[model samples]
Target: MSGPKEPLTRESLEPVPIQVFDDHMVLRPPNRLKERSAKRARTDDGGDRTVISRAENALKLLSQEFDAWMTKELDRLEEARRTLASAPSDAAADRFYRSAHDLRGQAATFGFPIAGLIADGLCIVLERKSEISDPTPLIDFHVESIRAVVRQNVREPDDSIGLALVDRLAVMRERALPA
Candidate 1:
């Protein structure tokens, strides 16, 4: 009875149709107007789009230089730490100070603001050594900061990460340095 309770099928469950526009049936983005505009800006060779090519080359050079500088600075920091750990002499402290100073200069030159700040902190701490009562704390702090610099660079491709670490180092340096 009542059409056998009307079997519920997919066709019966379907909703009403919605209308959508289809003006230009062209495929692949219809490069009509913009393609002509692009053609006007080309050279005879039509290979390197001048402004874009220059910017790309500059970026490549910067990336290469940044990688090279980072490697050298990391090596310098390692050498400084090793020297400090090996002996109890002013010479080791001096080496650490020089390395920190050089690193700061180079980092600044490379636009790595954070690395520069960290280098400044390390330099200030190392410079205060004149027969330190306990050099271990200072040495440990430098080691940690150096490790942070290396880690930050590895984690983030941007040099600004160095700035964040340096900001932290600045706070630590202020609290740790003697009057």
Candidate 2:
């Protein structure tokens, strides 16, 4: 409705005052990509070697404690299984599922990927039923397989025994649960 608006210029624009709240802090996260790119540009190689070395060393240190952590988790899972066996209630089933679920999520990180697979199969079976009336023998098989894998240090996915156990469980799960 009015005449052509004037273009925005540095001199014409007035600075608005910003009030800082004492309770809340405003933070701007640094652009990590830009920082990484800058570091790469500054260095002769593509990226920083020291940072990668530090990360690898930290992972190695964590790996040293992984076996103990895995054992503790397995113990918890076994306890849950025992509880499920004795009680055979929804609550006990839930606890058992939770234990299996936790192991499924962390088994690979704990250097027992085969155990993770067995846990996954167990989770699938448990997930199929809301209230497990009688815990299936398949459940026992899965749990025992997980324990065996961890105990035997069967970390690799390609281990013949581990693969066979996983395959057998998969077939059992399919037969027990169906689609």
Candidate 3:
């Protein structure tokens, strides 16, 4: 042992800089296909014409069925609204929410973008549990507006009446929910 032990102090300590060793290595696997096959797979337009044609045909078939599907969804929403109006229960509320949410998701796909917007507004109104008190009238209005959009085939988001209806619904929702 030394004659006297020196007390360790900050001045006596040596500072060492941290060295971060990054072992990360990115490995990009090479393409295994032969060049001729790869070139043949892509068309001059940069897309496979056969795939594009198949997709278009599928879209046409879905479009042909879209009207019926939209009508079915609207009917389901209406039924749920009626159930909620008649008997306000958690199950009914959940059903109504599910129906409205389905419409919100599918309306645009069914070529009724305006209806989707209306469904979205209805969902917003219904989401605030604290604000919900006898919201049957508001629900009715939303259902009717959606029906009108589908009935008139208001597919364009920019349609004057559709825009006006959406704006009016927004005002109504704010008035009803107050936030």
Candidate 4:
């Protein structure tokens, strides 16, 4: 043979090694194409080993603040209910809706997902404020449902009563929707 043999195995079908071309051995660049282009694996810092409990305590304190705020809102809701029962006007509806809407928006943040659901139900029912002829009972029921949740300290999504309340609200919303 006039030249060095070319490897002919099926595995040898790949392009010639960049390190070896013809009779000349090529010097590889210190930084390789693959090494330069490859991404390094990532791992999370996983954060402070000692302060975790402290952080949890801080969260508990914050949650207590939210709980207090929610309690005050519920009290306001009771007043709004009385007001609506006395005079069901857009102005009164606006106050009631704001209370419900505020609770719906914030209750979940303080570990009261069911309260949020019931409040959301009230918000939905009271949406067409002027259209509702007699919304006091429905509003009172939703407000009381949320109050029951807080009273029982019910937070689990699958809690039996909570689920029933959520289902009822879903049905109410569905019924209210235009078919």
What's the TM-score of each model vs. the native? 0.52, 0.70, 0.70, 0.61
lDDT against the true structure, per candidate, is 0.64, 0.83, 0.85, 0.76
lDDT of 3 at 120: 96
Off by over 4 Å in 2: 1-41, 44-53, 130-135
Name the better of 1 and 4 by TM-score: 4
Scored by lDDT, model 2 comes in at 0.83
Per-residue error at 87 for model 2, in Å? 2.4
RMSD of model 4, in Å?
Answer: 18.2
The alpha-carbon deviation from the true structure for residue 12 of candidate 1, after best TM-score superposition, in angstroms, is: 99
Across 1-179, the per-residue lDDT of candidate 3 in tens digits comes to 66556554432244444445587545443333353246554345656777799898899887999999999999999998888878989999999999999999999999999999999998987887468676768878988999999999999989999999999998888888855
- Give one digit per residue, the lDDT tens place, for model 2 in 51-148: 79889899989899999999999999999999988888889988899999999999998889889989998898888854444447878888888988
Candidate 1 lDDT by residue in tens digits, 44-126: 66466776888878876787677577668768777777877887467877776787888778765554556666677767767
Clashes of 1: 2
What pairs collide in candidate 1? Answer: 114-162, 114-163
In terms of lDDT, which candidate is stronger, 1 or 4?
Answer: 4
User: Which runs in model 4 stand beyond 4 Å of their true positions?
Assistant: 1-58, 129-133, 176-178
Quote the positional error of residue 35 for candidate 1 in Å.
53
Residue 119 Cα positional deviation in candidate 4, in Å, after optimal superposition: 0.8
